[model samples]
Target: MSAPSPAPVSTLAPWPYPRWIAHRGAGKLAPENTLAAFRLGAQHGYRMFECDAKLSADGVPFLMHDATLDRTTNAAQVLSTTASNTGGDHPWSALAQLDAGSWHSRTHAGEPLPTLENMARYCIANGFFLNIEIKPTPGAEEKTGQVVGEHAARLWQGQAVLPLFSSFQPEALAGARATAPHIPRALLLDTLRNGWLDLARQLGCVAIVCNHALWDAALVAQVHGAGLRALSYTVNDDWAAQRLIHLETDGIITDRVDFFSPATP
Candidate 1:
């Protein structure tokens, strides 16, 4: 006997992303979600990056983690006091004029917020992988996911490693599935809720990105048992990284790009 055919070798979905992912581009090294940040991450030998994507008021998909620009951009000074503070309420043209880097540091004072198209071009040309988090505004989750999914599919055409889409919203993932079923997706959870695996299966996700604190060896095994990859986010410490490594996690999204050394397999 061949030992029962080695228990049939349960097959998992194909995982195209690298194990080490730079969070929000360079992870606080440069302005997050800007071309400069992506470039910085690459300079640090990072081949994979994670950034947030959302839709502008005019329906253009752009890179922005927050619903409002006031935190990352000079929106308070650029937009009229009466203007809506939400990033989704502004057109890309208006968004383009706001300084997205000054808030971080004076060294990057003039760096502009980059569109998803611009970021995609940069990443594709440089042979980098991307994890696009669909961070939609309230009530706009479905449309934002649809538009971002469509744009991502178009942008990454002919590329070997396709962008992986992830979101905390099931509605957003559902919309993405409707728009571009070919693109791989992941479900992001801050906490492991009841029936989370079922929900991930329903959304057709190839992976589940969880809060770093949530994963252990058993959980990782469970995720693998479900034929899905396990990934953890915002892992900024050595202990966390070591734990994930010990647990055989599939991916680690980190803010410590410089510290972690992406060259590590």
Candidate 2:
């Protein structure tokens, strides 16, 4: 079945992943993309987590969502000498020194940013699955994807389940596919632009993770018809989750690890 052709939804193969995914590790409970958030997510019985991985100045892959460090880490205080607050602006040596968790609350203070290797060890040892979003730095999209893909392959070598890499940038996905074709990839959509489905097909995506509101019965059917699984992100409300369930989408990424039960769905 071609990716753009419609087929029966029943033609779908068994999904290799869990239905529930914790966003940015534990979402708002702890600092985003930190190991502390992953631990909290595990406590909530979440088996899968969605993280943003990007490259540092020295080409090391680390887990951080934004291009800048000011929002989630203490780059302002730690790197005061230089007014630069971008994660990619400094090497991992400097990024590793900042406090990543203190911004969330007093209890989570002093948490350091986790390297992709740090995350891999933690997840592989605990039998957890990660959806690594190739959040590339501007002008370095393909390079970030290549570095992340290479590291993910090496780190998770000989493991049963590899990481599911997803990205909004097609170049990033292409780069990952080039370096590590064996790992599964997904196309993340905030909006369904013209020829978006074709884009997913060209990238050889195993699934489509869209903004939750973008899905409807027709869209779900179209994706399934093309022989791909449908997934959504940042889904927090009960009504929206129920709607996606009604559509029978394959995956749901949520920040509300506290509310959703991963074991149930």
Highest TM-score scorer? 1
Question: What are the per-residue Cα lDDT tens digits for candidate 1 across 14-47?
Answer: 6777899999999989999998898899888899
* Candidate 2: residue 9 Cα off by (Å): 8.0
Candidate 1 deviant stretches above 4 angstroms: 1-8
RMSD (CA, Å), candidate 1 to true, equals 1.6
What are the lDDT scores of the predictions, listed in order?
0.91, 0.92
Best by lDDT: 2
- Candidate 2 regions exceeding 4 Å error are 1-9
TM-score versus the correct structure, for each prediction: 0.96, 0.95
lDDT of 2 by residue, 68-123 (tens): 98899888887976567778888989888999988999999999999999999999
Per the 3 Å backbone cut-off, how many clashing residue pairs does candidate 1 have?
0
